[model samples]
Target: MQVKLIFSALTMATLLGACQKAPEPVVTTDAWSPLAQRYVSLVLALGEHDKSYVDAYYGPAEWAEQAKTAGQSAADIATAGSALQAEIRALSATDTMLRLRQHYLITQLTALISHAQTLATGKRASFEQQAQQLYDTLPPQRELASFDTILAELEALVPGEGDLTERVVAYRAGFVIPQDKQQQVFERAIAECQARTLSRIDLPQQERFTLEFVEDKPWSGYNWYQGAAYSLIQINIERPIDISRAVDLGCHEGYPGHHTYNALLEQKLKNELQWVEFSVYPLFSPQSLIAEGTANYGISMAFPGEQKMQFERDVLYPLAGLDAALAAEYAQFLKLMAQLSYAGNEIARLYLNGEIDAATAQSLRQRYLLQSEAEAKQGIRFVDTYGAYVINYNWGKDLVKNYIEQGGSEDERWQRFISLLSTPKLPSSIAWE
Candidate 1:
């Protein structure tokens, strides 16, 4: 029997979990922002089984309340689920980057539906049996991989596995990246951040803020949150960035970037009803459009009215220890990897959606990502199950660039930029015409 194989290079990206919820406040805090409460509720429901992760991200009291509501009114579940979907759809539809995310949201919805449907039937064993059947049919490359394993890994990092209140306390305590190494990284990041700050909105250093990185933790590169805290940012030094990536990513991740923009908004926008939602970010909310877009455009926004080629040639390349030729080659390689990731994601999504054969999926991964035969085989299984999310990194970057360029620039435009981001529940399609 000629068995078909789906190459697995694309699948490797699928395993990289993304985003995280912010830690909730301890005191009442004015009933909390409705958007924040909404996300807190959803995380509590979807992540209830893993108290540690929920508590670590959402906090103790809020997680407890959310847990109570999870089994409450079906209307509440429907409301939460619909709101999430609506928010995501609005954000994604505004740009191609977000539009790609529509696919991801749908996949999550599908899984939630399957789970809910099983529960509605009131046949516990039957639900398990059906899930098992679904698992059984996954490609050999995907065999034996269970959600439990994924949850287990996540649980280890999050604190407070049981007791919502305890989980919340643990979440707050654990929300911070470690403290010992935080100052060192923060200092370096600050120095690095200043170089790019000229184009940023003017804010005092103290108000601008810095999050000290502490113990080694698994996180994406640093992220910024505008809240009661000023520019709440997290960084994992383990992910070393060469200079080119640093300049662009630094601008994107830090000053004149996400951190700068977020901090400015927190300070400038205090109209209780206006900027409150922006202060407390919701991952799938329209606020995400502002958060992700400027962060993505930080480099371009800072360097606008300047020569990008010059910066690449004079600043970034030399810092990375590469000559012109070598830099060009490395740049090309990175671009190719991004393209391959995009292509692999398309193939994976098609396969998972039942549009392609397993072998075809494998070929796509191998041909595009240049994966080892075995890895390629496994990747197919991964992508088939996960669908098109790998596009977010580069594709999102492109969309953000497009949106910013479309917006005309004025003097110290970064200030205006911060204002836009602070707008309450602004949709991704929000343009500055």
Candidate 2:
């Protein structure tokens, strides 16, 4: 049985009303443009200190070169970012859009300064603290005992096991997409997602992406957004890929996910509104919460209810030479597994906070997340490298889902979802309640 998630009517009304209200008239000249340019420059400068800071930049080549040549230290970058933040604060904007731009700048600069300070001092904050300061939202803390109900349910679903994790893993092993069939299945899934997205949202005809399979990554998939509405999407094939991942990664990394989100932002915010800040994506900012949350939610938006399972059963199963009969059961199993997604965040919090050791965290992940030894090791690597970013995938998705599905028809939800993707909205701006 499929369960539909919905927010309360009151929450829906509040968000919808917020979206409907008109902006105040512009009382001041455009002071934000200069600040926006400086914001981009500061991000590039900080990127020199931290290689992973600037996730994507499609802005001017000279700016990047200048940033590199200037060779600003993390401390120097933090000072400059503070100065920029002060200037931005001194400005006033009565218009709604201008206010949003102002808020976005302030939040992003705060994250920049915090990141730079951490780099300079080599002192990282606690997982929760870092998640709040860096991503502008705190992931909910969940107890390991809280997941026992879900585990019991999964037990009923997959009985007869030496270990529940081993049973689940063994059952799932049959559904792995073969290496030869991976490309075709993924291409087909991406095409369907693209077509569905095009039906509702207006994107640039020139918007496109190149997909590649690669190895040796902490994360499963990545979208390197190039300027001009293009992205280089890569999938890590070091571990076996289950058939369900075709649509999941397709919607997540490609169409109406990272690719579409970047394209719309490029076309609407950067090119149309002439907002320079949107041209550069800083990985450890509030913007990432929105980017990741929306991308994860995009999978369900593109294929609601049983539609995803049906697509896989009818189309992808044959393409991958998978057993179509197991599609529904596998889909159900995956849904149950998703109930345990937040386990990663909890594990990260414990391990990063020194409450648990690496070995303990790995064991917890295998038990809760039902990950194989290799997968659990990779997950720990992700935590070791990215720290609290593990929260973005699940927590971000929940926030996005709550905001977009407050109360609406499928079409109405798409409209709101597109509006979210094509704006400067941040995690702080979302009405979580």
Q: Please list the C-alpha lDDT of all candidates, in the order they appear.
A: 0.43, 0.85
Candidate 2 residues lying further than 4 Å off, grouped into runs, are 1-29
lDDT of 2 by residue, 1-433 (tens): 1112122122343434433322112212467777888899999999998888899997777789999999889999899999999999888878777778888999999999999999999988799878988899988888988999999999999857679989988888899999888887878888899888888888775566667888888888898887676677888888899999999998998778998998898888887777888889999999888889999999989898899999999999999998999999999998999999998899999999999999999999999998898899999999888889888899999989989997578878897899789988888876622
Model 1 over residues 1-433: C-alpha lDDT tens digits?
1112111121233222112223334333542334344544554564443222221232445455657665743334445666565655554246542343353343333334333343345333221232222111111122212223433433453345654323423433322324333333234434554566643456533443444332234333455454432444554444333334445545666667666656555544432333222333323223334455566666566555444445655654444344544444444433434434445545554565566788877765555444545556656644432233233344444554554455465443554555555443233333433
Query: Best by lDDT, which number?
Result: 2
Candidate 1 Cα misplacement greater than 4 A, ranges? 1-76, 79-190, 203-226, 230-242, 264-276, 284-286, 305-341, 351-366, 369-395, 409-416, 425-428
Candidate 1, run of 10 with poorest lDDT: 1-10
Error at 413, model 2, angstroms: 1.0
lDDT score, candidate 1: 0.43
